[model samples]
Target: MCNNISFLGPKGTFTHEAAYILEGNLIPYCTIPAVMESVSNGECQFGVVPIENSIEGPVGLTLDSLAHKFDLKIFKEMVIPINQNLIVNPKTVMNDITDVYSHSQAIAQCQEFIRDNEIQPHYAVSTASAAKSILGDKTKAAIGNSKAAEIYGLEILKPNIQDLDNNETRFVVLSKNDHEPTGRDKTSIIFSIYEDKPGMLYKILGVFEKESINLTKIESRPSKKGLGKYLFFVDFYGHRKDKTVQNILNELDGLTYFLKVLGSYPEF
Candidate 1:
């Protein structure tokens, strides 16, 4: 069995918690691309990185990296509920904090709280990184999860500080091989249309509709080629190997300028 699983971390990050649900030795990397590169080069058997958040939308770097740099397939997926907390040194109180640090997504999640308290918000590489940086500083606090506070020996000055309580993040496990058809699976794909014509996107989407395929999610990101040019990312319910799904792909092949099957994995 493969042993090492790389995740975005220095420990105490939300991705670290998501890594716990998988088997093998957990290794931490500083960035999402680093984690993917570890898996691509076989340094690790698998890697976990956040793909999207309910409140903050898609993680652009992760999506862009998968679309452009990595050939790895998504082997599995996990969705975890999020709860952000205000973590600080035990000796520090709310009045002592002038600046707060955390991942950009985490900071955005707690915008209301930060504005209300008039604390300067700074972005860190990861939530745990932020918590670790303020270990002895009374003027700085971090917005992270409870586990981060515990791991760093910090205190939670405030709990559940996110703007919304239903916050969740979706993480994907990257691996060299696609998972076997699990009957109930979701396939992710990326494609760019041929022209800027008005019906280009509509025609491509119609391929799925013609087959009655149920699409779970759809979003667009810049292709980085030029302005108004984009790549479309889609998730749908069905394994890539399914006959119906295969036929849909065959049809899409002719309609798109570029097409790539990211992977098929058991849906969360």
Candidate 2:
């Protein structure tokens, strides 16, 4: 197993939380691209990247990076609960808050809070960077997490300010080797059909249905080879080693023109 892990951001971001869950040490990068590149180039033993958020849907860049550049496999999965806290300089008060700084996704996740408080949102590179920026300006406040507030020595003006109480983000740990099944596992794969004919997707899904396998998610992205072509990426709730999952894949192998099993990993 790999000890060193890298994630997106400097520190105090949700990605950092994922890295903490994995191994307690995180090498933070400025962007998801950087994180994936580091892992692809073997700069780190493993890399964690956000795949989806309960509020904002799938992270497009992460998905695209997985589809395009990385031959890396999913080693583990983690779900980090998001709790957006309003943080500001020690001297700043709630009334004096003018511009609110945060990463774009963080701002979107706290849309209701921002709207209710009439706080103008400004984008920063990351949540930790936002906190740093707020500390530099007395009038600026940040919508980040408690970790960020603590890291930057900013006071929490308000806590748990996210719109959804159960807000969480799912992250995937990437490496060159597949993880051994831990009973509770998930398999991810990408496939392209011969054609976009009617009932083609249903026909593909029927294989899993017949095997009684459960599907977790299904997303489609452009094949990027050219216009019109598309690829279907899917996550299912079973390890590849399981009999049911194996049967489903055997069925799918007969149907798909191109298919790749990304990995089978321990579920978060």
Candidate 3:
């Protein structure tokens, strides 16, 4: 029914952790697009996928899929602390580990440790999947959270191996509808310009400035239509239904080549 929620999985992935923010029968998918596709095709009522990581910037696949492939709304956001650990078979030790496996992002986050230990890096679809792969194999270790170690019956060879101590990831819940406006809310939108010009973008920002809306984030992604053409994604502190936000969007709609209100959800 509508209670089924999909997440990037084999369970124990960060997205899996974020999916717990909502109550549902959590279903696991192999990829972010798969999770989104499940929701788009009505196989699941909601899906949770990571939007960005503190250490490595945004998850481009999730943003690109949301911009192009899926017509989904972000229902909510959940932020989770990430502590990358070196997980190994119970019998394996640091010296026995010759190769490491994990999602590219995880590998990137723990590059320092990998380099210091002289372990060859291999990529897996997800950190949980990496943990699954190294089962019964002593030479290979996986970099992931502690939950993955527990789920895969592995041992934590080293804890908090990520380069940074304050690692976190922001995940979004995708569904057909956005959350109802809470007084404290945030709106995300994507837009493109008619032509590349200096003042054009400046004028768009001016609208928010004039309305006194606090802009939280602004990022650009290639529109993929042509060179120099890009899509601008903006997150601001207000609900789409709020009068001031509506004013800013109305003005933006008229100014840009096209504008899409991504969604409005309670600020996390």
Candidate 4:
């Protein structure tokens, strides 16, 4: 029932692109932190945020926000192919570029290219924003994508410059209500175990194994409330309606002090 959406942006950001792919519309916002806040406060009916990237790993801020501040549910998922491009102002060419600007993740994905080209990497707020900044400085280039280069009217010096060609980012659609299954689906959950206990994770994962369910991803984040406690977030490849997935949840329900079924949504 939720219609209005929001995402990390000043527009032209990958999060914005991911939102477009998920909702087929633009949800205006300025940052992932802002997008999560809007969903938590009901400022928007739904929000989209990048959870992980194939080349760069987890987005720590998004995971932490989901773990602590929000009671949000992920209603859908989207996998957007990342194609990092080296962009420069129309007046500037490849050899004239001395420094590059982009979000930290973008810089990380294009590390090899930057190192090999001897271009200094400067972290900007977002990829789209980096492209904007490049428009102001002729010597400064940016590492973003083709969409961003197009949006900023910058010339693409290089395309698909990411170290990995299979680079993809996973975005989650968040809302207050759970999603109905679309036959093929995926479920996301978050839980934690005692920091001092060994094999606790193995036993918890064994539940999924015993039920013959496949885990799509597993990641750990600092609890933030304290130094030692940690939280684990997992994505599994089935809907909650499936008997095997339900049984796996039933087993987990009795074993963990804290557990939350974040969502059951059509897997993309």
Task: Identify the leading candidate in terms of lDDT.
Answer: 1
**Candidate 3 all-Cα RMSD:** 1.2
Give per-residue CA lDDT, model 1, range 17-120, as digits (tens).
Answer: 99999989999999899999999999999999999999899999999999999999999999999999999999788899999999898999999999999999
- Kindly list the per-residue Cα lDDT of model 4 for residues 129-227, writing each as its tens digit: 899987778789998877788887888878889998889998998888768878888899999886667888899999998888889889888877697
Assess each prediction's global lDDT (C-alpha) against the native: 0.94, 0.86, 0.91, 0.85
Clashing pairs in 2: none
Which residue pairs of candidate 1 clash?
A: none
C-alpha lDDT of residue 245 in model 2: 88
Candidates sorted by TM-score, best first: 1, 3, 2, 4
- Tens-digit lDDT track of model 3 for 84-150: 9999999888999999999999999999999999999999989999999999999999999888999
Q: lDDT winner between 2 and 4, please give it.
A: 2
Q: What is the TM-score of each candidate against the true structure?
A: 0.97, 0.92, 0.97, 0.92
Candidate 1: where are CA atoms >4 Å away? none
After superposition, candidate 4 runs with Cα above 4 Å error = 23-25, 225-228
